[model samples]
Target: MASVCINEALTDDELRSVLSKLEEERDKEMFGLVCKRWLRLQSTERKRLAARAGPHMLQKMASRFSRLLELDLSQSVSRSFYPGVTDSDLSVVADGFKSLRVLLLQNCKGISDRGLVSIGRGLPSLQSLDISYCRKLTDKGLSAVAEGCQDLRSLHMSGCRFVTDGVLKALSKNCANLEELVLQGCSNITDHGLADLVSGCRRIQHLDLNKCNNVGDDGISKVSQACSYSLKKLKLLDCYKVGDQSILSLAKFCKNLETLIIGGCRDISNDSVISLAIACRNSLKNLRMDWCLNISDSSLSHIFSECRNLEGLDVGCCEEITDAAFQGLGSMETKLPLKFLKISNCPKITVTGLGLLLGKCDSLEYIDVRSCLHVTKLACDEAGLQFPECCKVNFTGSLNEPDLL
Candidate 1:
């Protein structure tokens, strides 16, 4: 009689227990190859997968991985042959992965309102969703999602141009627990929509309104007032309509703001910048005020003196910023925590100012002085020798003559 194999005698539960002990994917694959039963068990235990979108492939995945919790069907620009995921593919995902928690469908051009409806009805347990650049989706689809997925904490809908105030209203009504919302390039959003959203979702911590031209001081002030304590990071890049009143409101109410980007907000002046620096001195860590031409040495002086915890700063292209700004920074008695600095394209800055900054900031790790008319490549090369071994300086366009070597 043939000897009985110990592996064959083990029950399904014991096999599963052995599989759970293997940490590496290679080890798990080897275990599955030992027998047909192990292979079947491995397929059922799989939890996350990222694959090209197709109806037939999705069907096969659903049948094989019944407990999959995360699915990524985002398409790459180089792979244009695959016409992108459609509503039918989403229907299959909704029907099969009822316990799904995270779904990413970025750049799925073929998906529209119909696909989102299927997701809303089926995936009530979802906590995060990224449909960024899915331009075909509008208020109708996202409203359905807000109504169904009340557990949602993060939502990214960047470049969904068709979305307007209506979706914000819907989300405000249902998704009160939302913490991160990225609406970059949704140009149709206005002050009223923002006020409504912030009133309901007071827990929002990170909000990005980059390129939402219609948003101005009124909307931003409302956000600062409602989500004052909870807000930590905000990006208003290229929101030209935003001016001093918005920043002033942030300084007064949002004391916990850690990161702020107001680049291209040309109307911002030294007064508001100084106010913000004083108010958020202890908490502010990163600040970018590039192209805010109205700010000058006074704002930089206050920032250097007050924001003791500041680690990163960018005032690039502020034409009015001159050597005086660095003079104040150099005069500081206390060692600065600043690690990154960018003064690129400021025509008034020269090697004298750069030297002053380098002398004081021993903690510097990265510096960008590119396009400063008076700064030379020769000077930058000498400065590189003095910087710490880890420091890197970008003087890309400073070379006016050929190197001697």
Candidate 2:
């Protein structure tokens, strides 16, 4: 019955209107099969396409969607339904979509330096490229990108372990307009590489160095000095080599930061955190300090007193935080209220302190208190009853896996 209804003849305006409402790729594919006219109309309307098919499908799409602006050939690393795209497949896309602006080849295992070089030479108009998890890519592939795509703005090469200073130098020399660069898990990079990267990309606003173990205080200090003027978001998760000196530099130079994550940077203490609060008080909205066990109530007090606009706060595993920290947050006056709060595994936070803190944060929508030994069922019950119906409290005893901050 559904097929019969869809198969009925419709005018061009009616078909175009119906096609405009279909956004999902699967839905468009199904609609295209309704008739020859529908197939033609779908091809004309398609601008973004995501598929896990191999070379043949890439060739078909290249001809079908003449106006395609973005193409995502990424596939799940765990279980791809079809064979992954290869260098030959990428060459077909490069030849077809010469004006493509965005390309995402994340987790495409078959893609290598040759494929990337082919893409770089063919698609000079590409602006955003995400080759994250493409472990086969190295400096050679990136050098091709630098030589070809000068208008590039955003690039994500996370988990590409072979990347080093050479790749950074090439991109810095060419992609001057680059604003966002994600080097997460690219452990080959050292301080010198980071210094050169930031020096060249003065307009960079967002930088991610999560799990880049070699990037220490010196690298971060150089970043603060060079890109601080435009930098707004910085993530340094699990970079244990970084110390309070790095945070101090960021607090002093990158005062315009809106989001800051320092999870697993255990060397930071109350002094640097306090300075960070005072420096970015008006601009900071989100802060993550999980696993910074040395941070105590004094640091929390300083942050609450100065950074009233803060919306998201994660003090997970901060063993030294006590009731005083919550009280400090309750006393703060600000129009931008806290929306998300996570204090899981904080041994010093008791039921009394948790209740008091909950009563004050009227704007809070999500509260996570897992593994708080002092917080009992009574406290959880009271919290649920007191807060608005819109709020969701997670007081489960078990610890949830850590997520992105």
**Index of the highest-lDDT prediction:** 1
Per-residue lDDT of model 2, residues 1-405, tens digit only: 455564467777799899889777789789988778889888967788787666777778788887788998887877644447799988898898876999998887778999989988999999999999887899999889877999999999999999998988998899899999999999999999998887788888889999999999999999998988898999999999988999999999998898888999999999999999999999998899999978999898787778878888899999999998767555545433778888989988987687666666678777788888887667667666476466667788354433536
User: Which candidate's TM-score is highest?
Assistant: 1
TM-score of 1: 0.91
Worst 10 residues of 1 by lDDT: 396-405
lDDT of 1 by residue, 120-169 (tens): 99999998999998889999999999998998899999999999999889
Instruction: Give the C-alpha lDDT of model 2.
Output: 0.85
Q: Score candidate 1 by lDDT.
A: 0.89
- Model 2 CA lDDT for position 202: 83
The reply for model 2, stretches above 4 Å from the true place, is: 1-42, 80-83, 333-336, 382-385, 397-404
